[model samples]
Target chain A: MDYTKQIQEIATRLFAEDKIDVFVGYRLTGFDDNQVPALIRESKDVPLLVFNQKSVFNLSNYLKNDHTRNKRVGLVVKGCDSRSLNLLLTESQVKREKLYVVGIACEGVVDDAGQKMQNCLECMVPAAVVYDELLGEANMERRFIINADIQDMAAKELVQRREYFEEVFENCIRCNACRHSCPLCYCAKCCIDQETATLYNGANTTSSAFHALMTWSLHLAGRCVDCRNCEKACPSHLPLHLFHKWNERVIYENFQEHLAGVHEGDRGAFYKYSMQDPDDFIM
Target chain B: METVTNQLVSIEKPEIVAPPDWQPVIIGILCNWCSYAGSDLTGTSRLQYPPNIRIIRVPCSSRVDTWFLIKSLQTTADGVLVSGCHPGDCHYISGNYFARRRFLVTKKLLNFVGFHENRIQFSWVSAAEGPKFAKVVSKVTEDIKKLGPLHLYKKENFEK
Candidate 1:
């Protein structure tokens, strides 16, 4: 799963050909095996770029940042990262013509503990769906595995479920780290932050967390790429993936087995509706 | 200086001791073209119904953001009724269809986070279905009454 030398060559070539102004990849933190996202602006720093299982941060998140916005970008993409990139392209947040994407057929990425991420273990798309130079063996198969937490929650009593989530929300610090880490949360002014916390209900901890999480999940209902950027960014380590995965399951069953940003020009499940959409939930 | 804000947040809502006459507060959000007009018909036709609902009008069902429901439960309303035009009956073509997708997800999402599934509801009422609108409101009000008040996160507020 190591493509360090290959990525460096492509990045060096892209810079040499004057095709990209910035190359977004992963670099060693100068101390650990784990890599931090590197935004390389000069060809001399192309050696800094690395691609491996430890490259956990989704580089596409930087596409919306000021450094790369409206600039030519040569970047790397794994399966999940490409999906997020696909969404950004569809949403018109980033133009396709202004970038050169080096795709990777990811096996899986590991966390600090060297364990494969939960989302990767259940990944359906294992290849870079959109890339200019793919880096690994591309295998796209649907691994429709329902997460244990969501299934277990479904089997539990409503009271127990509520009690569990109450703790989850109560622990929230409202630092807005999850929002900043989400690439799709690209609104010039975020809708959630537009209103003061006081304007919501009160500036209480659990209430604000509940409001923020619910609002954030709904905003990303169909478009989330399951990259775990928000989960990684949360200081409290909230099980944020549950919200997105739950919505994904519901949408998959009810809305014609739709997966977000899978096909080109796919406007997400919420944007377009089918006449066959379930109306039984309505009274 | 916090006008129209956080007063709901500061109310440390106590447990519901249902008095013999404590009617549940139901917030009814209706789309202008269909459900709103249907409620108007309910009034004009002298239809007798429970007066528990507080109606708010929106241009279309899709205009109702997900936060509106979350805020309603966290603050004042015991229950919410979001009614829109039936499929293919939308005044703005397919507004309700898009809204319908969101409504289902929002309902399930809220339920997943701990609220009873019945606390938030949805229906499609055409402009001609005045009686149907009355029936829906009564059903929603009844469901909320049984579920009691939304007692989650009604703690004391703080200055952010």
Candidate 2:
């Protein structure tokens, strides 16, 4: 992880050469052990780039946002973050030529509590799958594991399972933090917004909460990079991964062990064609 | 525990059941080219279906965004049925295809968050199939009734 000097040097070079209009990275917050996503537009701001366990938020989320969209940008991405960036490229959300990606051979980033995230712990690609520059020492590739929560959910009876998820949906406040925090949720006028949806009366009821959460999750099914940003952003602390992990498991099992954004050109599971895909589920 | 005590009280003083007078409200979003016309045909042929369903016609099934579905659940509706043209037969060519992809993901997410999957339905009904449209509506109504009212988020509102 001791790539601080290297990161600073790269930032300086990008600014000096004017190769990028902005450099999006992480900087340590003044009052806490956590790091916040930083946007550096000038050469003087290059010193703000730092790498440590506290640098948690995926920088890729900012790329699809208004601030960075259509701009020549330099971005730092960890193992998990890189996959998301790769997906953005594959989906044509951003142009590859416009980006100067500084790839990190991540040795796992820790959460605010200094604990490793589940996805980081089981991360198979500890380096950027698609980047213009590489950083840190490459680690051995690991195996992807089905998250434990999803495994436990699979064992529940139909009624019991329904009850378990019902409790989770009950806590949603309809703030759409999960959707906003998500990099994939870039729709200009999201359907769930109050003014746009005539059907949803825009009230914060349990039924509405259930519908909103479900719709958001499904929207990200194959595209989600397991960044867990949505889960972290959710004020209710809902186990959003249960939905994602379940979809991931099914996609993996049915679609030739497909992983979203693992390769630069890899299309999503639904977007691709295969003679071997499971036909039993389709009517 | 407080939970145990509450359960015991509920068991000791059982709530009496009322007669089955509850009629579920179903919100159906029909694609203008196919499902909407199918419902129109049901009216023309005088084929009787449950009056519980209220239809909204959209230009294409893809226009039925996730927000509309959420809004339906929050309103008076007990179930949502999004009916479109068969795959590859959409009036906009690939509108139904996009809807199919979206619906699959939405269904999985809903199931994950604990909403009963039976409460929402996505189907393909051609403009010529009036009987099929009626049958689908009736079937969806029955399915939602078996699950009862969506009280997962509504119980707290009632408690206040």
Candidate 3:
């Protein structure tokens, strides 16, 4: 769904009516057709809002940033991005009343190479679960399917699997772009940061990568919405989805087939329990 | 005690044979309110379990970070076990309930990444279940022994 025209009109109306103090959307990156997130504070910038295939960044990451905090804001979100926003509301990180949400019924966003991103291909919900005004037609037939890569990883031997992740970890520079780009990693002072972490010296070692990424993924176990922001931000091109999809797949299997951020006020898998929860793994 | 003697005599060897004297270094992260108290009860009651497990008591099993489990496996530990209060019985009221979900995901992830699920174990041993605690420890110890040493995540020569 090409929503460039509709987004421009909505932003203009929201600004003209003074319904929002700031309107967050995407603008042309100036050099390419690809879009970059733009925070427009004035009515004049309303025309810059655009939503197209290249609008891939989950704009919800900006909700916790300094620019949008405590402001009456307007923002656009795709299916996965809306889920993150839903989680932010449930986690008390963002107030739903202070913002206007323009939700999009996404038709699988494509990469720069024009192929459907892996997360989009596996997406089960293509419509926003929470939105003040939803755009586009919802595709109701998609079902939650495990990613092909995860299925392949499951078939490998134990040593082979360890060797694969070893390579993935070795290439990591510990730059933490993945953590910074993640919407759920909104901690004021992240524990994985070397200065604050008491458990392990935050170094660029492979061991540190294992520690940091494992902690990061575990924290996002029941919360990640597969926005793919972390994967897109990684400089090493490491398949960070392996960690998240692993957690997502496991939680789906063991915790009442739970999916993250699909509803308002959902407390996630770890925060709540059911007596029917699988205990065969426990002794 | 009698339970410990029986476990020592009934130990099973894995398909891959190693030296008879090599014992797995198992790290047990036990919750203070239940599993740790249960272990204490085992000692006081003279119930015997394997001595290979080194216990670390945490406020709750949920406090056992996934990093700690992974780091233990990568470092000195040959196997890891996390024991907590039974579901709905956490001292902190829902700490173990949450831990059950966390442990399930952690175990599945480890197994997906080539670590055998047997290398790590999760159990609930209530404060009064001294015999049950002994049985769990012995069972986990024997399982680890049968799988031999866990060299999968060890730091030495892992760079390759």
- DockQ score of each predicted structure, in the order shown: 0.32, 0.17, 0.31
Model 3, TM vs. native: 0.90
What digit string (tens of lDDT, one per residue) describes model 3 on residues A79-106?
Answer: 9999999999999999999999999999
* Lowest summed lDDT window (length 10), candidate 2 chain A: A274-283
- All candidates: CA RMSD in angstroms? 6.3, 6.5, 5.9
lDDT ranking from best candidate downward: 1, 3, 2
Lowest summed lDDT across 10 adjacent residues in model 3 chain B is found at B1-10
Tens-digit lDDT string for candidate 3 (B58-130): 9998898777888898788878999999888988987877777778788777776556678879999999999
lDDT score of residue A80 within candidate 3: 92
Displacement of residue A58 (Cα, Å) in model 3 is 0.2
Model 2, residue B147: distance off in Å is: 2.8
Top DockQ: which candidate number? 1
Q: Which pairs in model 2 have colliding backbones?
A: A165-B114, A199-B71, A200-B71, A206-B153, A218-B105
Better of 1 and 2 by lDDT: 1
How does residue A118 of candidate 1 score in lDDT? 88
